[model samples]
Each structure stands twice: as structure tokens, then as C-alpha cells.
Target: MTPPMRLRRRVRFVFELARAVWWLTRIELGLRRNDLPALCAKLGIECDLRSAAPPATEYVVLPRRTRTTVLACAYAVARWPMGSTCLRRCLVLGRLLRSLEPVLRIGVRRDGELSVHSWLEIGGRTLDATSANYATLGSP
Candidate 1:
């Protein structure tokens, strides 16, 4: 790649990362202050509060390259100070990759104590490693 092109890509990546972090912050704050449905509404995600399956709404389909870039940014921001939980990560990723039809899943397990986990999936494939230990409760 040309020097200018490389620089442009880097700039775009940084911008995407910043945007992801901003959204993550917003989601974290919303989770802390409001209910799930309210947060989803605020983020412009149409969700069915009564269903465990992924949202069944059409979204603006993003290009595969753009979706990949956004996913990279989302993962990068997952290490931020607030310590991204799976739920937060899924929420941010789901928002960023809505066009790809990401599903946000929550599961629970008991290994002496109750543990809950969340993850994102697309096309029946999980974006993150999920423990076989947890029993799926449902998706949001």
C-alpha cells in the first residue's frame, strides 16, 4: 500500500476505535441507569423484550469490509477501563454489526455459585468463545 493509503487506513481505524469506545461507554452508562428495553431504544435497536431470540428487524446492510473493521474496533475497546463484560461487549458489537444480524445471547451456569455469561453470534456462529459450561437462558 502507498504511504498515504496506509496513513488513511490507520486514521480510519483510530476513528472507528474511538467511536466504538464512545458507544461502549454509552451502553455501560445506560445499563447502569436504565432498563434493557430503554437502552435498546436509545441505541436505535429494535428488540423484543419478551423474546429470547435475536431481534427480527431489517437493518442497513454494511459492507463486509466495514463490518470487519467495526468488529476489530469493538474488540479493541473491550479492554477499556470499565472492564467490558460480555453483555456490554455483545451490546456494542450488536449495535456496530447490526447489518450482519448479530444475536446477543445470555447463558447461565452453576459451579457452586450461579454464573451468567453473554455472547454475540452471527449466522449461527459465535463471535466469541463461549463456555460449554453454561446452559443457554435465551437471547435478547
Candidate 2:
């Protein structure tokens, strides 16, 4: 059987998915960088909140690639106010992004109300440059 610590690590990783979804939904929603990054910052915090206890040892819990959790955490901080609509979308899209890393883009209809917007990219440019239309601020 997996050790207790290993079990905690695995569980933490699963919830990490939830944290990622929440943040990504916010980012894809086009909520400004500072606010969104703030949310993403909470991914680790939120992950711990979701857990019964932290691991016996540091697990180095992280996504497979660079700044994945950071981006996700930033997203959560920015869009947590949007509630479950954004969250639901985040889960779906975050899963897609995980598989399509460096090549994922998820955009939504952007109305004046706080909305969710997502786009995928590689290196620096957009993998799919489609506009989420959260506001008229950004061109599709």
C-alpha cells in the first residue's frame, strides 16, 4: 500500500487540479494580471485548506511544467468572486490545458459583468489567439 505520506501527496495533487481549474478560469476570463496573479498565489494555500493535513515531509507538489501552479493560483485570486460558473468552466478547461500544455486555449463569451476568459500559449505567443470577449479591451 502507499505510505501515509504518499497518500497525502497524491490527495494533495488531486486537489491541486481543483486549485488549477479555479485559477485558470479566472485568467481565461481576462481579470487583470495583478488580481489574478494574487488568486493564483493562493493555489498552494487553497490546496492546504482542502486537505485534512499537510504531508509529513515536503512533497514538492507542483504541476509538470513551469509556473503552472502560479498561473493557476493567480487565476483563482482574480476570479473567485465570479462564483461557480467560472469554477465549473475552470475544471473543464484546466483538464484540457493539462493535457495540451503549451498548446491550450479556452475562451468564453465576455460580457460587461465579471467573466471568465482563457487562452493557451507556447513560449510567449498564443497557441490559439481567439478572443474571450470579456470586455472590448482586448482584440480577438
Candidate 3:
């Protein structure tokens, strides 16, 4: 790539990184304040609160390239402050693909130690690195 093109790409990446950081912070704050409903409302997204878990096989996934882009952006931007990548990345990816109607899922396992995880699923397919590790707690 030409020097100017490389510079432009770098600038675009930085801007996107900043936007992802802002969304991550915003989502974290919303959760901390117990204000996710309000946050989603503000973002013009309808929150689907369900007490039932759906079958994991019930989704028509987007194209492979789209999924790759979403995951790449999530990992690239949410790699910091390690150990909490799932939720933040989910939120970031959800915001990025709001039109896809990302389904946010929380899963818990308590055999040895109680652990909870959050992830976003699009078209029924989970969109996180650890998607297979957890059972969905409710509809996502």
C-alpha cells in the first residue's frame, strides 16, 4: 500500500478503536447502573427479555465474511483489560451490527465454580471465542 493509504488506514483504525472503546464504556456503565433497558431504548433498540432458552441450531447465519469482520473488530478493539472480553466485545459487536438484531445471551455453569458469561448471537450462531463452553441461560 502507498504511504498515504497506509496512513489513512491507520487513522481509520484508530478512529474505529476509539468508537469501540466508547461503546464498551457506555455499555459497562449501563450495566453497572442497572440501566441497560434505558440504554437500549436510547439506542433505539428493542430489548427482548425472555425467560426461555432457544435451541442453538435455530439461526441462519450471515455470510462468512461478515461474521469474520464482526469477530475481528470485536477482538481487535476489545483485547484490552483482559479477562472480560466476552461481554464488552459482544456489546461492541452488537452495536456494530445493530441492524442484524444481535441477541445477547448470558450463560452460567456451577459444577465446580459458579461462572457467568455474556455473548452476542446473530442468526442463532454465537459470536464469541468461547461460544461452545456455556449453555444459554435464557433466550438470546
Which prediction has the highest TM-score against the true structure? 1
Task: Choose the strongest candidate by lDDT.
Answer: 1
Candidate 2 structure quality by residue, lDDT tens digits, 15-122: 655766544554545444444334433322111112222112212233465344545444444555556343334333434345433322233353565654544333
lDDT winner, 2 or 3: 3
Worst 10 residues of 3 by lDDT: 51-60
- How high is the CA lDDT of each candidate model? 0.66, 0.41, 0.63
What lDDT score goes with residue 131 in model 3?
51
Ranking by TM-score: 1, 3, 2
Task: Name the better of 2 and 3 by TM-score.
Answer: 3
Native-to-model Cα distance after best TM-score fit, residue 115 in candidate 3, in Å: 1.0
Residue by residue across 1-140, what tens digits does model 1's lDDT show? 56998888777777778778888878878999998767776775544333454422233344657754666656665687888577777677678777677656567777899998766556656665543445566642
The number of clashing residue pairs in each candidate reads 0, 17, 0
Clashes of 3: 0
Which structure is stronger by lDDT: 1 or 3?
1
Clashing pairs in 3: none
Query: Model 1 — TM-score against the truth?
Result: 0.70
Assess every candidate by TM-score.
Answer: 0.70, 0.26, 0.67
